[model samples]
Target: MRTTYLTIAGRIRQELTEITQVVERVQQIWQLYTSTQPRGNEFLVDATALNLHSFYAGIERLLEVIADRIDREKPMGSAWHRELLQQMTADIPGVRPAVLSPETRTRLDRYRGFRHVVRNVYSFSLDVEQIVPLVRHLHAVDAQIQRELSQFADWLEQAAGAE
Candidate 1:
């Protein structure tokens, strides 16, 4: 049981790290895309927009993993990412629910929409308008996750110290 708990904790840490890096990259790209006035070839901007969507997809995957691990002892389960989030909110008091605070929920919603677009290979192009909002949402989610993780880490440390 201890080993299982340790493993899950390690995975949560890993996912948190990945999410942070992705959020940072998304912010950097957003800065680059928004700094200058619209000019030059449209294709380059279009490609960058797609890349931004891809980064959100990556964030979604990480969140899904973290949520799943929180709910189940093992990670090998059905794709219950959404269900897991709901269960987490309903089941775990304070700790896990902190992971899905309002800000995080907004980011997840935006990511869900972007994921749908990417999965369907939708032709709709993303402009600075969409990217800016998404980046802001992503940053908010990142902050929430960081705060939650810190709390979680503290909890783990206290538990370990007790043991």
Candidate 2:
């Protein structure tokens, strides 16, 4: 049981590191897009759209790990993606604290919705107006995720020690 807790905590920390890399890349690409005068290039817009999709996907991966490893239950069905995101906001008594705050969940929900649109529609069809705000708020959302997950990792470590 101690080993299990430590292993899960390690995995969470590892995933957080990888997610940070994705966030940095998103910031770089977004900066390039914004630096371009007029910022209307179709290709840059497409790139930003893809990065945003990747960002949300990375976040979902971390949440999935928490659901499967810690929560011992994963959501099922066509709406599982949304379900999984919501799961992180739940405080499962005696199991684990909520991995995300409701505010963070609300911000991330936007990215999740955008991710679905990115998957279903062609890149050129993406709305720059929508993507712009998501990119602008990326840092705030990422900060919340980092803080929450880091605290969760601390909890895992403490639990391991207690065991």
Candidate 3:
């Protein structure tokens, strides 16, 4: 059980690292898109698709970890998983506002829906058009999450010093 927990934790950390890298790359692409003012939209669209794919991949990995833990009959592990999810959600501000931001919330909700489809429906595919907007929203949320993680790290350091 301990090894299983460590394995899950390591996988989660690895996925988080991948998520950060993809988010950084998306930011770079966004910068290039805005700075150069590219003549054609094709490249920009392709970059957006790639960014979305990475974002979804990260989320899928996270859900997989949660599912694995549940399958192993480790409900306590889910508390940490839920905390991470809540932190991810709270880390993004306007991206998924507590109230009055149905569209943003729905975009993320689709991920959960997709997980359900994977687990239950078993015959679902992601269409490009359906995922693009969600990716755009995720880009916005990624910025907020980056900021939140930085702040949280600083808070942790300060608390550790006090103790």
Candidate 4:
């Protein structure tokens, strides 16, 4: 139905908006990380970790929207994050095509693991070393997500127009 495609297109737009917020937050975090004088201070490190956590949180939120609207599944398990990512890359039965490539999923797993760490620990305890790599790669992941979502948006528009 065209309504289904329209729904997906609408939700994708929402996710893209959320992605913008996520990128803004991540850029802010990266700025804090870079702009700190003599670096590795307590406040900067703690705030950056929390902000980095938000980056992954944003990624998950968008994926949840896609799953709920398009895949019609959200996976239930102790490893639901992994399942959710896999779901995004899977072709749902006559529902919709995969929303992410395996490569993007792999890149996203890094954020997923960081998100898990952020959840279980106190922010002050976050290691600067571990956080550095994710921060460094943040733009790459964000760009990939943007490119992929743009393609999906085009697909949704085409699907909607087919009615």
TM-score top scorer: 2
lDDT of 3 by residue, 28-49 (tens): 7755655664444446545745
Poorest lDDT segment (10 consecutive residues) of candidate 2: 39-48
Quote the lDDT for 22 in model 4: 68
Best by lDDT: 2
Enumerate residue pairs that collide in model 2: none
Task: Report lDDT (CA) for all predictions.
Answer: 0.56, 0.87, 0.49, 0.79
lDDT (Cα, tens digit) per residue for candidate 4, span 62-115: 788777777767888799999999888887766777788999999899889988
Give per-model TM-scores. 0.67, 0.93, 0.49, 0.86
Error of 3 at 38 (Å): 5.2
Question: In model 2, what lDDT does residue 146 have?
Answer: 86
Q: Where is model 2 more than 4 Å wrong at Cα?
A: none
Question: Candidate 1 on 139-158: residue-level lDDT in tens?
Answer: 66667766765565555545
RMSD of each: 4.2, 1.3, 9.4, 2.0
Candidate 3: list runs displaced more than 4 Å: 72-107, 110-140, 143-163
Between candidates 2 and 4, the one scoring higher on TM-score is 2
Model 4 earns a TM-score of 0.86
